[model samples]
Target: MIRSASQGMREGRPLSSSQAPLNVVGEEAQSRPGSGQPAGTTQLLLLVSLAHLISHVYILALPPLFPFLRDRLQVGFVELGLALTVFNVVSAVAQAPIGFLVDRIGARRVLAAGLGLGGLALLSIGLVGTYPWLLFGAALTGLANAAFHPADYALLSAGIPKTQLGRAFSLHTFAGYLGTAIAPAVLIGLALLGGPGLALGVVGLAGVLLVGLILPMRVPAAQDGADARRRPAGSPTAAGGSIVTPAIVSLTVFFTLLSFSTGAIQNFSVAALVGGYGITLAQANAVLTAFLMLSAFGVLVGGFLADRTRRHGDVAAVAFALTALLTLLVAVADLGPVVLMAVMGAAGFLSGVIAPSRDMMVQAAAPPGGSGRVFGIVSTGFNIGGALGPLLFGWILDHEAPRWVFGAAVGFMVLTVVVALRDRWLAQRNSGAGTRGG
Candidate 1:
């Protein structure tokens, strides 16, 4: 039996039911033990993770295809870069609105539409003969890309048990990273075997198939009416109130700085090592690969830690502080190649360790029933940082300051720690005030 929000509030617990018709039965079943409920939950997790994975694969597919596209279209690097810029810009600009839509309409509908449209757009790119057509296709993909975060997070928050939410988030993030990790190899191998056009068509077909798989699974809708009716008179989401609180805004900035730090390392570390440390390209790339692999492992570790602790902001603060110190060490140290690789790997691990905790903080701070919009608004920080990091770090490289890449990374990490600690303090203060009032 699915309990309404009013019932749950009277009972002093928020039940795991949603406003969407399809989700009520599924969520209720998942909340109880027996009848293979665990297996059902696992299936739900896999489905959500797959959605996350596909979104990232589409996001990354274009980068590998860029080389082939440039050759086929006879375009310069600048024009190719513009195509990427347009994609990210469109995604960033559209994400918050899509998030709002996710709250209003339904996450499942938006997510299914995004996958289908993105796949079709990628197929269009493969078929188009002109540069303008390529740009058009990329823009469509971006608009589609904007749907994933809001929809995915909202669904997970509604469907998954609170105890397992951290792990669910970890798995979702890992799938995204895996998608990005595989995209280069998958796209390039396909292009090599059967031309870029055929490669793109294959990937696009896969996305369309994914949409077919997802459509039958119903998603939960926002619980605004239930929450509004049950909430205290002066609460944030009551009486036509705003969901964008100070904690949320702070979290948004925190995400931006975190992305900025990671973006610097991901985009420039190899070039910086080659230019500044005189490491060979292969050696630098090897170090980078190790960092990435270990970082993924760290996310797994972080998930375990998140479930054991409620102080998510503290977890993020400590991880990022250590990450900053490690990154600074990388900037200043002139160690042997092996030692440098070890240090970089450690830094990567610390950064990854923050991921689950970072997400949990946002989950903690979100106004009740507003996960989609909050995540959507905060995630734009990623696009903002992603857009800005390349420009800033590229400038550093252009000025022949390769060592400054790590310097800049460390700077961003410090800023991230500050914001995270502040968020923690705010959460703590709010909790205390509530305690006293009670």
Candidate 2:
């Protein structure tokens, strides 16, 4: 259960028998942002979001430097590509196990350790500058990458006020998108100023520095500790039934489809526009950039919408249906440049709108004290989609079938709509059954 106003606490101070119990007013005063809460909820939110931003920065860091790395390290493109494949594969394999670790030990420590490990990996790559060392660094970074989703979601679930969760989640996601958007320029600029070595070194140091903020954070208790204190020994969660229910499996599919659909637009839209429609490269890139920026803005708007309505399924369904139509139009029609940009931007915004509600749906599926395991397992869909989408879309582009990119995206979006609605229905049915049983 979520902490109510009466359950709120002062910064760094847990309730003790020696102290008087807090009144609702007193607890609210301590818990509310900027009201003398220890470490402050607002501060924790920003710190966590900043960590998310840096994680994405590291994810995209090497991609922008591939050309520089090729020349500097004297390696072929295949070798560099292998580094990325290793990174994604290792991360995909490790996320779920690490999630269980988060639940068992705690999220903050795991998150801090990941940051430290990732930082050391990058620092090693910069200092060593060998292809084998690069592969080693990539593998270590992958292990570090596996830790973020599980730890970050667990932290947010435990720390943020229930009422404010939607907005908090949106901001967190927005920071990540912002990181990806900036990484190319950040890497290019750093490489140009000094070298790729300098760029990697600086980024690595940034991660190490951020650890300072995380270590001293006097945040609220994590769900693991709270659950141990609050639950009776014989509770369902204590009995340990499997967390991988049908609902969890369905949500995983939903995430995979969502990632694949969005990855198509993100990775291939510019290429498709140029190849299929005779658009200039500049025009295609402009459209893609607009799409990405508008998507980030839409996440903020969706946060407000998520807070306002409990029907996240309806929101996701309607948004996805419209997105599919727009994608199909893009597939079949050759619109003017301005019109194409506008339509793609709209599609991006709708896609972004689905994000917070998507997280909310996952949150709902997560049993208390099991958020880490649930998110760890479901978020692996991202890696699956990321790995597979590129292969399939790159093949279509290679085969000179550009319009099929949009067509495939439309198919994925339609499937997502069905899954979203079905998940919602199942959740409602379970909730109703539980209420009657009670």
Candidate 3:
């Protein structure tokens, strides 16, 4: 009976304590004063969002600096690309281990250290006299970058009230996108004013300062010693044990597919529009800008929907289905430029609307105490998709098959709907089983 209950809970059913079922570890972690409730919630959310912003800024800082590095250091484009590749590869490899550290020593310390490390590494890039040193610095930055998602999501999951989690996730994601949007302008402006080296040094110092600021703030741990002390002697921690599970693995794949679809559009949509749609570069850029801006706003709207509905899968399914339809229409239809822009904007809005609900699905699937590790493992999907999507879409563009780009994205969107529905079905089945047992 106990084994069956544990299995059921893992499948998404809620089990009573008497059932001796698997509990989401650390579900009660936020009950402590100044952790998840009213007094500390606002402060915690702000700090986490700031961290999210900073992480994205750092991720983008190097890219804008690429031209500068090539001109000043006389490095080839391949060498510069290698530097970015090293950063991403190192980050991808290190994220899971860092998540383990977050779970063990707490997110507060890890987050602070990551900020400091990334900042110092960026500073090193500014001061380095040789190309090898630049590569080394990039590797360090990647190592630092790996800490954000796992730590940020873990802390937010443990510290925010369940009722407000959707908004928190939306804000966090919005902050990241904001950071990405601003990085180019900020870096270029600083470079023009003070030289590239000086700009890099200043930005790096800012990161260090943020570390100092965050060090003093408390973030709730996924599992704390105090909470452990309060539990019955033999009772399991919520979602304790190994972080790897079938459900988590499925979510990981889901994220990878989602990223794959979006990454193509983000990286190549302007080029695709210019090449295939007979649009000027400026016009393409304008449409892309509208898409991104509307998407961000859509995330805010999605937050409200996430809070109002418990059917996260339904929300995701509907949104993605719409996105797929719009994207397919863009591929097949010979619409006017304005109509194309409107269709793309609508697609972006639908895609954005899925953001908060997608996050809620992950939260529901996460084992309480294991959030850090679980998120760490799952988020690698983004890295994988980021690494691969460009190659795939770039091939389509290189072959003059630009229309296929949107079509490919549509295919991925359809796959995402399938995954979302599968997850929803499992959750519903588990809920029904728990009801019957009760």
Candidate 4:
């Protein structure tokens, strides 16, 4: 029973065959129960993945280029380290406001601005020669990096079905990691071909140009935006969104600890191997590659697992425990480079499992139409921890001992476990009341 658009021309007119199936599927998709994704979600995922890849292309390139940056600018360890530290600090703090902007303006504009501006910031880092000017460039880089999540995650929340979020997040994380993993190997060789500084500068130029090209690209329409404007005033995702419920607030604390832990791993792992374990920089970087490669794999697999998982939080908790044990093991164990690399690989694998599940948890908890702001706020934890972890760990390595770095990381893990246990207990209490969503 379908009414064709052309049926008005004549009641006797035969209906086009294509109209029948289109009506059936469209009606079925619209009628399906629950908060589900749109058909456009798959394309959005591709675009998001590409955006992540581009963003991380810069990230992966940065660590290896630190040597070049140091020599070219004639700066010391403190200066170079501070540049990165400040970058993350600025980037982390800005996410909340950026999130707010995305909520009002839309993801299309924010996404375009972040990537496009990020490209400009990077290009300046290359063109600028003075130490003070270079620091300015780093600040700009931070701002550019800070702008991506709110818009990207918001699009994801509205377009994709809640159940499929794990896979989407995993794809996002994996794409970024893949970009990071490729940077050192590819860019380093390119740097060798010309000059390191020249290579980096050229790469940045390409990124800027690419962003300019991409910003003008077309995007699909989002129904969520229209729906939000039509909703009653004082929705949870509006004013009520600001207040995190007790359990949700607790989860935020857990996210903060997780952020801190990731920061320690990302920032210090290379330096620790070099300074504490007596490994050379090249050797340490090689080990870092292992860590990132496995981490990339972990993100992809974690997403897959999360998508299939009936109990995502439990799976996340188990993953967290493994990461904790791995951190502790790294702290206490003394091993050769080969053995250490193997261990890091295992640690990376286990740690990778939590990312997708964690992202899903946040998405699930976010008040409707508030994904942009929530992602923005939560993402700050990652960047802020990025700032703190290194400064804290580097101080220990430079002054006291390398062992302290892992010990501090262990503290973060312990906090994570406590939070996870608390969440489980609350879930159990709620379960008996027949309030558990599952």
Question: RMSD to the native, candidate 3?
Answer: 5.8
Most accurate candidate by TM-score: 1
Task: Output the better candidate (1/3) by lDDT.
Answer: 1
Per-residue alpha-carbon lDDT of model 1 for 1-438, expressed as tens digits? 855655766764434423222242325323334432333456667888998888888988778877888898999889988888999999999989998777666677788889999999999888875799888988999999999998888777766666777888888888888887788899999998977887788888889999987777744424223433445566665454777778878988998998899999888999999999978999898888878877888888888888889989899889989988988888998877888889889988888888888888878767666677888999999999988889999999999999999999999999889888887787789889999999
Ranking by lDDT: 2, 1, 3, 4
Model 2 Cα lDDT, one tens digit per residue, 223-316: 3355334434554555676889898899899999998999999999999999998899999999999889989998888888887889988898
For model 4 the TM-score comes to 0.82
Candidate 1 deviant stretches above 4 angstroms:
1-6, 9-39, 221-239
Q: For model 1, where is the 10-residue window of minimal lDDT?
A: 17-26
> TM-score of the candidate numbered 2?
0.91
TM-scores of all predicted structures: 0.92, 0.91, 0.88, 0.82
Model 4 is weakest, by summed lDDT over 10 consecutive residues, at: 17-26
Q: Report the number of backbone clashes for model 1.
A: 0
> What lDDT does candidate 4 reach at residue 9?
20
lDDT of 4 by residue, 1-438 (tens): 645434622443321211211111113222134523334456667777778777787655556777777788888867877777667877877878888777677676788778777777666766666678667877777787777777777776665555677888899888888877677777778767765666567667766666654454333233124335433456655444553477557666777788777767777878777777877888777777787788888888898888897566787888878877877888888878888788778778877888888887777656655667777877776765666666677688788577667778878977887777777777778887786555
Name the regions of candidate 4 deviating beyond 4 angstroms. Answer: 1-39, 60-63, 209-224, 239-249, 274-284, 427-438
